[model samples]
Target: MIGTEFIAQSPETKPFWEAAGAGRFVLPRCRQCNRTHWYPRGICPHCLSTTIDWQDSPGEGEIYSFAINRMGKEPYVVAYVALTEGPIMLTNVIDADPGALSIGTSVKVTFKPAVTQAPVPLFVVR
Candidate 1:
């Protein structure tokens, strides 16, 4: 199983982790550029502005790309999910048949406990 060590929980990403712990999905939006970004940062990557703010995400997205990891202790699908709000996130897709996954398949966020700390977000087919 994946662990919290795989995730970087720093001041810059605290809000994201906090929201995930509460079963909510959030993304940072640049107030200046009006764009949403992943891998939360202090400044907008696009505009380099310090006006980023946390916003609740609808948690609905489509698979932008995917690959199955059959060599691991357990098989799992890793994917880039394109959120409805326009940001793409690299995440794991769980609780579904790997063969049934395809590009453009709709998915929604779900939270599961991490090995050492708060819950982390995963995606499920919807």
Candidate 2:
């Protein structure tokens, strides 16, 4: 994660990462539009409203898609977890047999530290 250093998150998202560092999965919800989104932004993507709130995710999801990255700098699993709340997040999948991966396997969020000590949320089969 050197050159790929974590993008400095917006102030709107700082608390999300802080809570993640503390091992909680928080997501943004726009009450006005009644939709949930990730990577916390100042405005709601659905309705373009400033009305947003954060809630703890159940941390449960199913793999919407994935790839066994065998030829990259280091072999890894990259996947889109379709969060139970409706947002799909791109994150790493850890601690599972890549060969056994499937499109709809259940997963739960886990935290791993980035270079800056902010925890990056990943997932593992549950």
Candidate 3:
């Protein structure tokens, strides 16, 4: 119940949340382009191919970029994770000690409920 501010989980992203609830990092992998992408799509953004599959990832990544919010309504760490399979996921980095996280730091995926509906992928320092 850390930040249950009533986030509406979209139907398009429901599968991703469902996977996270099962402790899996599911993403859309385009078979034609051989690349993975976040915000799952029906067609490959790279090649415009409709051959897509849901694959489980290792959930290991690095902090490609980050910001330490100190003055926001509720301070938090927002980061872009460069996943091993070449997908960049925009997520919140949790359980980080203040001033401890930085760009390029290694991170791992963790799950927390998305407003009690389903688990969502969150990141933390490895």
Candidate 4:
């Protein structure tokens, strides 16, 4: 989580951050399209419906893709994790060697507190 940043929650994203603060992972599921998506919002992107609700996810997924940035003082991993719920989220992988991670690596959601007081969602090898 070398560069994970948490920001002040807006109305559309408050519950998400609150749930994360409480150690729960939630995603917006579109009631109309019955699909989940990354980057929470007031309206469902898939169906363009306002009938969106929060659903608690198991928060486990496989690495869809990744890259290691070794130029930083300490190398860190940047990755796209394909969640079991069907959305691919951009996140960082922690607590493992960069050389040990690759496509299809299993990972689980983890939260880290930021100066903004909101929890940043990250991942770790599962």
Candidate 5:
């Protein structure tokens, strides 16, 4: 496993982190624009609306883009996953051969448990 650290959560992103700890993946949605967004902020990036809601995601996505980090002893995949729910998430692609991945590769969400922090959301080849 890669290095893990406890990340601080704010009031706006508390629900998201808590849900992840409970094994659920959620995204922030703007009630005004009817669009989902990532990074789980309080306001919508699209319409700048403070009216937001949380929606459960299917946790399925496709690799939008990726880079293989070979500087370390083990190579890992860092990728942008285009979620099925209309958002692109910056995340890591785990449990797969780095050389086998390509743009548009199908992925499924999986969690990486942290020491003190909530479980992190990651993806694996599907």
Candidate 6:
């Protein structure tokens, strides 16, 4: 396990952390553009609209890219998962062999306790 460092939560990202604690994955969507985005911003990246809402994700996605960190204290896989909702998120891929990870591999979200009270979302092979 990596060092449990608390991530500073902001108002815009509070919903995401809340949902993760409840074992659900969520992302911000732009009402105007009907597009989901990562990194929860108050304004939509697509249409630059302030009308954004939180939506539940299917918690499934495909690995868009990945890197195996062999030099770290503990070997782990870091990846960008392309959510079915159209947003790609940078997250850790866990519970699988790092040697076998590949682009387009199916994965699902799994929440694990973090150093802070809130849980963090990680991905596992489906």
- Which candidate tops TM-score? 5
Candidate 5 has its poorest 10 consecutive residues by lDDT at: 1-10
Worst 10 residues of 1 by lDDT: 1-10
Number of clashing pairs per prediction, in order: 0, 0, 0, 0, 0, 0
- TM-score of model 2 vs. true structure: 0.89
- Candidate RMSDs in Å, in order, are 1.9, 2.5, 3.3, 1.8, 2.3, 2.4
On residues 1-126, what C-alpha lDDT tens digit does candidate 1 reach at each position? 342225688888888888888888889999999899987899999999999899999899999999899998879888888999988888889998999999999999888787776788888999
TM for every model, in the order presented, reads: 0.92, 0.89, 0.84, 0.92, 0.92, 0.91
Write candidate 4's Cα lDDT for 40-71 as tens digits: 88898888999889999989999999999998
| Candidate closer to the true structure by lDDT (higher is better), 2 or 4 | 4
Candidate 4 segments exceeding 4 Å error: 1-8
Higher-scoring candidate on lDDT, 5 or 6: 5
Sort order, TM-score high to low: 5, 1, 4, 6, 2, 3
lDDT of 2 by residue, 27-111 (tens): 9899898799965898998999998988888789999998888886767888888999999988878899988999999999887
Which of 1 and 3 is the better model by TM-score?
1
Model 3 C-alpha lDDT per residue in residues 1-126, reported as the tens digit of each score: 222123346765566667777888888888897888876767788899988888988889998987777786767887778888888877788888748887889998887765566776788889
Worst 10 residues of 4 by lDDT: 1-10
After best superposition, candidate 3 residue 62: deviation in angstroms? 0.5
- Regions of candidate 6 where Cα sits further than 4 Å from its true position: 1-7
- 3 or 6, greater by lDDT: 6
